[model samples]
Target chain A: MKNVFIFTSMLLISLNSYAAPPTFEILIKDHLFYPDELIIPANTKVKLLVKNQDATPEEFESYELNREKVIPGNTQAIIFIGPLSPGVYPFFGEFFPKTAQGKIIAEEEGK
Target chain B: MLLNSVILVLREVLEAAMVVSLFMAFTTVSQQSRYFLLKAIFLGLVAGGFYAYFLPEISNWLEGIGQEITNTMIHLGIFLLLTGFLWLISSNIVLPNRLVKAVMMGAIILAISRESAEIMLYISGFRSDHFLMQSVLSGSLIGLGIGVSCGIFLYHLMIALKPAAATKFICVLVVIVGGSMMSQATQFLIQADWLTSTEPVWDSSHIISEHSLPGQLLYALMAYEATPTWSQIVVYLTSLALMILVIISARFLQGQPKYD
Candidate 1:
C-alpha cells in the first residue's frame, strides 16, 4: 500500500510539472510593448500574458512567431510562442504598426 | 497613418469581399435569386459588430485561449459549409433553394464575422485619437472602395465566362479558399497548443514578402503563407483533397456522363 501511494504521488507530481508552463508578462501602453525586446530560452515553449492599458484594442501579431491575438482595452490576452531555434523574431501591433513594434530573442541556455 | 489604415482595412475587407464575390458568382451561374446573398452580407456585418463588442469577454474565456478557439471554430465552420455547398453542386442534383441559401448564409456569416470583427476592433482603436481620426476614416473609405471594386471585378469576370466554364472556375476557387480555411485553423490550433508546432516546410519570404501589397492580396485570396509549417501544408493539402474527393465521389454516385 505504501509503495502504491509513492508511485501514484510520483506520477501526479510529474504530470503537474508538465502541465504548468513558464509565464511572462508584457504590458501594452499607448499601443506599444513595455519590453520592446524580450529574451527567452531557446527551444522552450513559453506563455505571454499581454495587458493592454490603452482605451482601444490592439492586435499582437508576429509572423515569425506565428502568433496573433487582439488585446482589448484594459484587458489582457495570453499568447504561446516558441520551442523555437535561436534567433530573433519580430512582432508588431497590427492596429498601430508604426508605433507598436517589438522583437523576441531566443538564446541557448547559460548564454 | 492614412496609408497604414488603408492597408490594414484593405486586407480585412479584401478577404471578405473575395468570399462574397465567389458566392455571387455561384448564384449568378445558377440563376438563383441573389436576395439570399445580399441578406447574408447585411446579417454578417451586424453579427460582426456584435462580435467585436463582446470581444473582451470572449478573449478572457477558456483560460485565455478563447480567441484562438473561437477563430478556429469559425475557420472550420467555413470549411465545412463550403464543402457541403461544393458537394451539392458537384453532384449536379437539383439543389434545394432553402438548403443552398442556408449553407451560403452560414459560410458567409462565419467568414464576415471573423474578418469584420478585426476591422471593427482596429477602427475602435482610433476613436480616442481624434487627430488621426480623419486620416484613418478617409483611408478606410479608400480601402473599402478598392476592396469592393476588386470583388465586383472578380464577380463580373466569372460571369463573363461560359456558364459551364464559370462553374468550373468557381469550383476551383472554392477548393482553394476551403483549403486556406483549413490551413488557418491548423495555425490557430498550433498557437493554442492543441497541435504541435514544426519547422516550416519551406521559406518563400525571399521570393514574395508577406508584408507587400501583392502578398497581402494573395494571402487574402488564398491564405498564402510565405513560410508554412509541415502541419499547415498537410492540413491545406488534405482539405484540397477532401474537397476534390467530394466532387469526384458525387459525380460517380450520380454517374454523370462526363467531367465538366
Candidate 2:
C-alpha cells in the first residue's frame, strides 16, 4: 500500500509537468512590450499571454516566428510559439513598430 | 507615425478596393444599379463596426485561438464565395442575375468587413490621442484617397478594354485574387495549428522586400509573400489549378446555356 501511494503521486506529478507548456506573460503598455527580451527553454513549445493595457489596438508580429496577432486595447491574447532551435527570434508591434520591439532567446536546458 | 498610419490604412484599403473594383466593373458591364454597390459598402461598414466592437469577446473564443480561427473563417469564406461566383460564371448555367450578383456581393461584403474592421480598430485607437489624431486622420484620408483612386482607375481601365478582352482579363484576375485569398486562409490555419507548417520554399525578400510599395500592392493583388512555407505554396497552387480548370471547362465545354 505504501509503495502504490508513492508511485501514484509520482505519476501524477510527472503527468502534470508534461501536460502544460511553459507560459510567459507579456504586457503591452503605451505601445511597448514589457521585458523586451524574453528567454525560454529551447526545443519546447511555449504560450505567450500578452496583455495590452493601452487604449489602442496593436498587432504582435514576427517574421521569424511567422506569427501575427491583433490584440485590442485592454485585452489579452494568447500566442503559441514554436519548439524551436536555440536562436533569437525578434518580434514587434506592427502598429507601433518604432517603440514596441522585443526578442525571444531560446537556450538549451541547463545552459 | 503618419507614414505608418498611411501604410497600414493603405494596405487594408487597397485589398478591399481591388475586390470592389472588380465588382464595380462587373455591375457596369451588366448594367446593374450603382446603388447595389453603395448598399453593400454601407452594410459592410456597419457589420465591421459590430465586429470590431465585439473583438475582445471574439478574441477570447476557441480556447484562446479565437482570433486566428475567426480570421481563418473569414478568409476561407471569401475564397469559397469567390469560387462559387467563378463556378456560376463558368458552368454554362445561366443562373439568375440576382443569384450571380448575390454571390459577388457576398464576397465583397466579407472582404470589406474583414479589412474595415481592422481599419476601424486602428482609427479608433487614435481617437483619444489628441496630438496624433490630426496626423493619423490625415494619413488615413490620404491612404483612403489613393486606394479608392486605384480602384476607380482599374474599373475604368477594364471598361475601356474590348468586351471580350475585358472578360478574359477579369477571369484571370479573379483566379489570382481567389488564389490569394486561399493562401491567406492557409496561413491563418497554420498559425492556429489547424494546418501543418514547413520551412519556406524560398526567400524572396532580397528581390522585393515586403515592406516596399510594390510588394504591398502585389500582396494585395496576388498574395505575394516573402517567405512562404511549402504548405502555403501547395494550397496556393491548388487554388490556381482549380481556377484554371473552371476557366478551361467554361470556355471549351460550352454546355447549353440553361437560362437562355
Candidate 3:
C-alpha cells in the first residue's frame, strides 16, 4: 500500500510536466535573431514567444514548418508549433532576410 | 520546396508586371510613359531593398501591430489611389498628362515594391544551406520566364481588345483585387484584436489544398482561402460590390456628354 502511494505520486509528477507544453523564447534585435539556435523536445506541441525589439516589422517565416506570422516592432507574438518530428527547422524575418535568421532544433526526449 | 520559391516569386513578379503592362497599354505605350514606368520600377526596387533592411526595427514598432497595420495601410492606400485614377479617367475631363503619369508611377512603385519584397524574403529564407542549388536556381528561372511571358501576353491581349471592353475588364479585375485586399486588411485588424472573428463558414481544403499549384495561384490572384470565416466572406463581398458600384458610376458619368 505504501509503495503504491509513492509510485502514484511519481507518475503524477511526470504527467504534470507534460501537461504544460514547454515554452521557448526568441528575440529579434538590430535585424538579427538572438540565441539564434533553440533546442526543443520533439513530438510535442510547443509555444514560441517571439519578441521583436526593433522598430520595424519582421515576418517570421519557415518553409519547413509552413508557418508565417508578422511580428510588429517592439512587440511580442505567440506561435504554437509542433508535435513535430525530430529535425532542424529554419526560420527568418522577411523584412531583414539577410540578417534575421534562426533555427529550431528538435530532439527526442531526454537525449 | 524549390517549387514553392518559384511559384511564390512568380506570383509577385506577375502581379507587378501585369499592373505595369496595364498602365502601359492604357497609355498606348508612349515613349515618355515608358520612361516613367521604368523609373517607377527602379524606385520600387530600391524601396523594397530598404524595406527588407529596416524590417527588423519597423516590424517591432507600434506595439506589435506594426506589421499588420503597415501592410493594411499599404494595400488600402493603393486602393484609394487607384480609385482616384479610375474616376479621373472615366470623367473624360482632359486631365494633365503629368498628373496621369504621376499616378501611373505611383501604382507601378507599389506593385513592384510589394512583389519584390516578397521575392527578396523568399530567396533569403531559402538560402543554400539546405536545398540543392541547381534545383532552386532552375525552378526560380522557370517561374520567372513564365511570369514575364504572361505579362507580355496580357499586354498584347489588352491592346487587341476594344477600348471599352478593355476598360470594363480592367475595372472588373481591379474590383476583384480590391475586394481581396480589403479582406486581408480586415484579417490583419482581427489579428491585432481590433475586430472580432466570426465562425468559419466552411473548409475547402478537402477539395483543394493551398499548398497545391492551382491553389497557390488562386491564393495569390484572388486571396482564395480553403477555410474562410463568415466575416471574411462578408467583407470580401461587400468590398467587391462597393468597387463595382464605383466603376459603374464612373462609366455612367463618362457617357454623359458635356455641352459648352
* Candidate 1 positional error at A102, Å: 0.6
How do the residues A1-111 of candidate 2 rate in per-residue lDDT, one tens digit apiece? 999999999999999798567899999998889989999998887889999999889989886677888899988999887676788889999888889999999999999
lDDT for A23 in candidate 1 is: 84
lDDT of 3 by residue, A19-64 (tens): 6567899999988998899899887767688988976556787644
Q: Write the per-residue lDDT of candidate 2 for residues B176-209, one digit (tens) a residue.
A: 8899998888888877767765656787878987
lDDT of 1 at B205: 80
What is the alpha-carbon RMSD of candidate 2 to the true structure? 4.1
Candidate 1 lDDT over residue span B137-174, tens digit each: 99989989998999999999999998888888988998
Q: Give residue B91's error in model 1 in angstroms.
A: 1.6
Best by TM-score: 1
Ranking by DockQ: 1, 2, 3
Q: What is the C-alpha RMSD of each candidate to the true structure, in Å?
A: 2.2, 4.1, 11.2
Candidate 1 docks with a DockQ of 0.72
lDDT of each residue in B183-236, candidate 3, tens digit only = 767666655445554434675767876657777667666777775666778888
What does the lDDT read for residue B119 in candidate 3? 65
Residue B113 C-alpha lDDT in model 3? 73
Name the regions of candidate 2 deviating beyond 4 angstroms: A1-20, A41-43, A85-87, A106-111, B92-96, B250-253, B256-260
Ranking by lDDT: 1, 2, 3
